[model samples]
Target chain A: MKAVVVGAGFAGSLIAKVLGDNGFRVTVLEAGTETGHDEAVHRFRTALVKSPLAPYRTTVAAPSSDYLINTGPFAYSSPYLRMNGGTGTVWTGITPRMHPEDFRTADLGRGRNWPISYDDLEPYYRAAEWEIGVAADADEQRQHVPVADGYAYPMHALPRTYLDHAVASVVDGQRIDGRELLITGTPQARNGVPVSGYRPDGHLCAGYASCVPVCPENAKYTPRRTQKRWSPHIELRTRCVVNRLHADEFGRVTKVSYQRYEDDTTGRHTRHEVEADVVVLAAHAIENAKLLLMSGLANSSDQVGRNLMDHPALLTWALMPQPIGPFRGPGSTTSIDAFRAGPERATRAPFRIELGNWGWGWSAGSPDSDTAEFVAAGLRGYALRKAVADRVGRQFTLQFEIEQEADPANRVTLSEDRDALGNPRPSIHYGLSDYVKDGLLAAKRVSDQLFELLKADDYTSYKPDEERYFEHNGEPLRYWGAGHSGGTHVMGASKHDSVVDQWQRCWDHPNLYAVGCGSMPSLGTSNPSLTMAALALRTADHLVSHRAEEVRCTMSKAP
Target chain B: MDAFVELSAELTGFSAEELRSTGLVEQYAELAQDATDAELIQLWYTGVWRGQIPSARAYAEGLAWKAVGVAPPGTGAPGFGSWEHRPRRSV
Candidate 1:
């Protein structure tokens, strides 16, 4: 059987690997050009602002940033790279699994419950861990989340930096809101010690402080690694954007139309078509919804591009009494998971406290910008030197990824705005509900108390006029995006309310599978990549088995 | 140079020996010949990630912000002036 997969990110690459391994002829379409490791490293080294999207910009495979138009009050701060490796190449590589209770949000009266539970995705999560080389101690994970017995991580957790050890020693076992705040190693997808030298373009993490912007050491697991593993069985095409899907009389997706761009400019492109027995839309949540809406397919419920969700992050930074060295290890190596799930979640959202090792890099630029300001101010000699050392050494930041519920009003729709390719830009409307605001307030209270405990001087503040700031309890609060986007094409048990089923198969089209984070009915307090990979793998398994049965039935009916 | 080394070691909690290994001392010695206290602080951190600074731990202390010739937070210093000349970045 012939299968066509769109988007070569984490979900698409893994699904293609599975389908190819299952004896299906696979053709993977990637919108961006194939970005090699050395080029990315060179770009990162030469970039001025070392953001996550830095390495892939200005090149032929640049991200779709220049074309996007935001019409919402809260700008979509999360910028996505449209390269072959996709956003996975630039992620922080932290891979915390969703708590089992996260799957039961609706049952617990917090948010909508997933059609499938954590248990349903458990095996696939383990499979993804091995494939991605997750470094975590399963026993340590059991303290706050559920882990199956004998389900050890593929590699040992990366060593905590001296700063992490200091913070953990001070804050671990401290009670906050009736739960103890223990700083533990966050499960990460970066390479640690190898499991029997089974290296597939993988290397042990060497504490590169700029994991989000780029892993110069190539230690982080990107989808390019997945592509390498399955290259023998999969036919991969680069710079080909899947534009639309065509359905047969039986309401099954039979073919896909695409535009192959000659250059990075979206307008200069050639149109092409490919026929397939199975068509999978594994693009990111927003892009998947945009394509489906443009094709006029799989929107029978009028809910294709509704219910967008992201981990709206509220940031706090400070100077400690004693310097806990920052900007050494991964972007973040430890997190406080106390507030991830609990009874308090019903009224206010739950959050995870991610301690930044990059020292206010996300909020304010790091050592370079901080030092540059002093230089630009005309400070000279020892006085200037001392000022630079003091600020750079004492810097630290805390990021609270506060959860947002799936509000249908906060959605993605086709805008009147069009890109160079004449495709409509994704029109998004996003706002913070009182539930999320209360969570931010609670997180702020906890942060204030924690800083006091550590004797850290608080330097955190926000602009009053910022659109992200909201008046709550007569106090203004602010937030930013954590770059996690989901819920655009929500899945559910029924066709009336959702776009896909639990397996991510479109309800309106039999042969269409709209995989990726788009199918997530609700996002638990975890990064959506691992969960999306698990779901995509499960979908691939479902397709292969079901397709085999159909083929067998046809053969039996034939002479 | 010796005074800066001792101060950085005290603030960063790293010994002077470890600090010297980062090879920042070479740059420090060069800057010390002519650099003012504020300039010394600024130059050290500017080279922190580039392997000019001894260690990441020492860089985080940011004691230079309290040093002379630096403008107060937010306020730009008038060529080698104090923080009073510059607006504060935070309270």
Candidate 2:
């Protein structure tokens, strides 16, 4: 059996590995060049603005279509990589499983419900945690989501930063909006304690605060780790952009067409096609939708590129009364797990409050801006040095990743603009619904109360001219994309309402699967990477089992 | 070079020896001809000269991390569980 997986991201790499291990030939096609760990770290260090895409090089031939032309009221400014490892290379490595209630959000009269329940995915979730080498305490994590009773992560949980300790000291038992606030160590995929029998591949966490753009020590999980463990049957072709998929009248994917680029500098490329028994689209949510829309496949329900969603985050930063040692560890070591679920979600979106360890870097340009301000204020020498230390050391931020309900109006469509390969770019139309806006309002109210409880100086400010800025209830507000994009190719029970089935296989095509966060019906407050990995593992198992069944039928026919 | 280092010391509140210890004084002095007083100070603190970082070494040696009493992110491997305790220079 032969399989062609598009996009060498976490999902694609894992699926390719499983297929290769099962005696199937797998060809993994990636649109971008492979970036080495040292190269990425160097790029991040030299970058002027340390955005997520800073580490990876963007090629014209395989352009990261992150600069989407917006046709909606608000700008969808979330950027994703199109490199060999995909956006997984630049993730924060925080992995939290969705709550059981997250599968049935429609029951709360909000987002759509998932066709499969959490019980069906719980085992796979554990498998993904082991695959990704997640370092977390299953005992503590079960408080938020249901983890299997005896299951524990591959490694011990990452230590909470001093800032987290300080915050918990004051606000651990406080009640806001009738919900008790508890600061817990978030489950992260970065390496931690060294266990005897279950050692992760990479080195332990070395306290690099640059996990978003790059992890210098390779302590965080990336698809590159899985790619390193692939069997000889798997072939990875970088800089090959898959443009379309060809399906026969029987709705079986027969051909995968792509353009192989020579290099990024020259816009030179050659077209090629490969035949496969199965084709998997493991590209990021937007890219998968774009490919399906371009190929005119998997759109029987007119839902291939509709129902776009993202965890639109609202950030609130403040200065603590004393120094709490910000920017010392990972990007975030702890989160307020109180508001992730409740009865309030019926009227507004639920949110996960990630306690930022990197200080006000996301809110306002930090140590650099602090130096500039001190210089401008006529402070020089020792006074300037002392001021920056006092101020920046006390800096902290609360990132509220509010769950966005899927809306058909927020979508990705083919743009008129063409890339270097003459392929149409992804045009986005995104907006926040009233329910999400109410979520933002509720999050701000909670932030105010928390600030009061901690006696911290609130420095949160939203400008009117910001890109994602909007007016809600006569107050200016803004949101930043958490880079958790989903719902472009949603999964459902009925073929009339969704593009893919519960197995992430296309409803219209038997041999085609579009796996990733794109197949999620509703994104709960948790990060979607772990869930996407679980679904990919499940799909791989399904494909392997079905292939066995086919072999058995062939043998019986021969007899 | 000495004059540039002296000016940087006055603006950054660092002594001449400390500024020279970073080993970026000569490189920064060469780039300081086109910079304003504030930009020069920012260059020492941020390792950013005219919008671009000179090198990875420059970023790691940035004075801002020293001012805040922490190593620059992605450099100076602080080892596992180092963030749990208070920094030596906590205010």
Model 1 spans with C-alpha error above 4 angstroms: A57-63, A195-201, A372-378, A465-467, A550-559, B1-91
Clashes by residue pair, model 2:
A381-B13
Mark the regions of model 2 whose C-alpha exceeds 4 Å error after superposition: A549-559
lDDT value, residue A193 of candidate 1: 61
The lowest-lDDT stretch of 10 consecutive residues in candidate 2 chain A is: A550-559
lDDT of candidate 1 over A138-207, digit per residue (tens): 8999888778897778887777655566677788888877888888888888877655544535556655
**Per-residue lDDT of A244 in model 2:** 94
- Residue A394 of model 1 has an lDDT of 66
Give Cα-based local distance difference scores for all models. Answer: 0.74, 0.89
**How well is each residue in A81-131 modelled by candidate 2, as lDDT tens digits?**
999999998898999899887899899738799999999999999999999
**Can you tell me the DockQ of model 1?**
0.07
TM value for model 1: 0.85
Candidate 1 has an fnat equal to: 0.08
Residue A517, candidate 1: alpha-carbon lDDT: 83
